[model samples]
Target: MSKTITLLGSTGSIGTQSLDVIRAQGYRVHGLAANSRVEMLAQQVQEFQPDWVAVVDEAAADKMESLLAGMPSPPRLLRGPEGLIELARHPVDAVLNAVVGIAGLGATLAAIESHNDVALANKESLVTGGHLVTEAVRRNGVHLLPVDSEHSAIFQCLQDAHSAKTLTKILLTASGGPFFGMKREQLAGKTRADALKHPNWNMGAKITIDSASLMNKGLELIEAVWLFGLPPEKIQIVVQRQSIIHSMVQFSDNSVLAQLGVPDMRIPIQYALTWPERVPGPAPELDFTTLKQLTFDVADEETFRCLAACKKAIAKGGLAPCAANGANEEAVRLFLEDKIGFLDIGRLVEAVVDSESFGGTYTLPDVYECDRMARSFVLAHI
Candidate 1:
């Protein structure tokens, strides 16, 4: 049976690579979505010819329609958040959500409600509304395959181990980002260029900044807990600079199992697309002979305040994670725009999280309110 896929954020790094994997495996690309970047999306449409497309920017949507003027049957174009949700709920085998930030929440909810399996690369979706998402999955019987490398690794490691009772802990690995050891004083005047220079992966500016602060790993920590049904304490973050070993799972019997591969999103993407049935892809083979060393160390929570903030959020429960994620998103935006320094990013998030009221509720509205409150708090602080 040919699997049908609806790809959200079809113009970004993960989206493009996911399409590459889909093309290589002959999966049907039923829908494509992006925030803007319609030119690249148009190129994807020309190659794969999905049935529908959604653009966040109206101008880009118009341009996309114009670019595909001569197709035998051009895709129906959608504009704005409503259109993105509509494309997400379209009857498809899987929705590969690669769209960044909190904007991805609605589409994710739509996919889950429609009973479509999700290939989730959007960390904020899980971070902001982990409980809500898990409930939706249960109500709809939809499987969420993690498209992020670390979570994907944990997913692969748990294939043979079904019982959560047997699991002792989930060990999530981080690349430690660019400024792994820099002090807050040193990062006071860092440029966007410095933060964008990720040591392990090439990604979008927002996510790149998240990586630099270890906030990406922080978000992933909450995400892993929700995905794996593990307690917050059961999840540990270790800095693995080589990026060879993505993540690990430890059993109660003192045995550790890890999934290792070269730092490529395609491997995980292909796995999620063909989940429960692995297929070959064009990703580079992990040559362990040449890859001699894999070093692991405790994350420096003192230096990278985001990780500690995430720990507090998870411990606080309820809407704290949502607040943290929302504040971080605003902080990242500010940093990218040269309105804030690198160290101020975490400071901004911490301040908002510290001030937000935790209702101990995980409903969609509660999460959304927390996000709004956090963003507002951050803006006011700035």
Candidate 2:
């Protein structure tokens, strides 16, 4: 069936892949939102011709206005963070939230409050505000679909209610990034360029750096805890050298089901959009005949302190994951700008987490306050 959707972060890696899915599925776009990529955003608006468009950056919004002046029937334009929030509240069949960071948390909540089923690519939404988002999902009776490959794999395996009832634990697989085997001493001199060279996936700079530091996997771990109602210990991180075997679920009877495919984001994006109803997608099938091997190794959390800190934070519960996420986002930003060393990324995140007592029930305002506190701590200490 044809569906209407709103795409947040329309110019991002996940956003663009989502557009590809929309194009293939003939899904109609209700709205499109982005931060500052006006040129790309303009092209998207022209193609999709959404009823509403939002630009988070002021200058970019001005540029977008001028660009839209020539359109015979340009969609309504909403500007700044408020505009993004408003765009999320506009009811659509599905809201594909691909917004990159913690900024996505608010929009995710807005969409849910509006009773829109959210196809969430923004892991930070759950990482920083899992309780709030999950509660909203439960209250609003909207589906919270996972767009991350590992989570999608786990989601797919849990499709059968009969088997899902006996589910015991999840084996979350990781590509191990570029510096998988490197020790702390070996990582000291790694540069931003070195960290960005992910061996398995093509992702944005911030995420790429997070992957190298194993912080991406850490954030995903926190996200899974919320999505699946599983403890951190139950979701074991296995280093699957090959990008295939995205993730697996182990049942109480010792049976296991795994989702394997080529490392294309489109497969999960498409599934999230057209869930419980499979359709032919642009992504290719896995060539198992030519496959060499699918090997596993234990994640060296001692060497990758970010992953360790995340496990600790989730176990601590409440707003601890929020602080951890805020710190990692800030640290990754500094690392990208060459203001901090690669190892320092983990050091800063772990330190910020250690310095705070992040507990208690949180409101939307509380989430923002904790995020600011964590970011401020990063700046003060750095």
Give each model a TM-score.
0.97, 0.99
lDDT of 1 by residue, 1-382 (tens): 4899999998899998998898898888999999889878888888998899899888877787787786777899889889999999998999999999989988999999999999999988989998888899999999999999999999998888564469989999999888887788888888899999999898888999999998999999999989998888989998899999999999988789999899999999999989899777979999978987889988988888888899888888888999999999988998889998888898988777677557576678877888888989989998
Index of the highest-lDDT prediction: 2
Residue 59 in model 2: lDDT: 96
- Model 2 is weakest, by summed lDDT over 10 consecutive residues, at 352-361
Model 1 regions lying over 4 Å from their true place: 162-164
Q: Which candidate leads in TM-score?
A: 2
- Angstrom error of the Cα, residue 14, model 1: value is 0.5
TM-score of 1: 0.97
Clashes (N, CA, C under 3 Å) per candidate? 0, 0
Candidate 1: give the clashing pairs. none
Residue runs of model 2 more than 4 Å from their true location after superposition: none
Q: How far is candidate 1 from the true structure (C-alpha RMSD, Å)?
A: 1.3
**How do the residues 251-364 of candidate 2 rate in per-residue lDDT, one tens digit apiece?**
998989999999999999999999999999899999989998989998998999999889888877788889999999999999889998999888888887788678778888
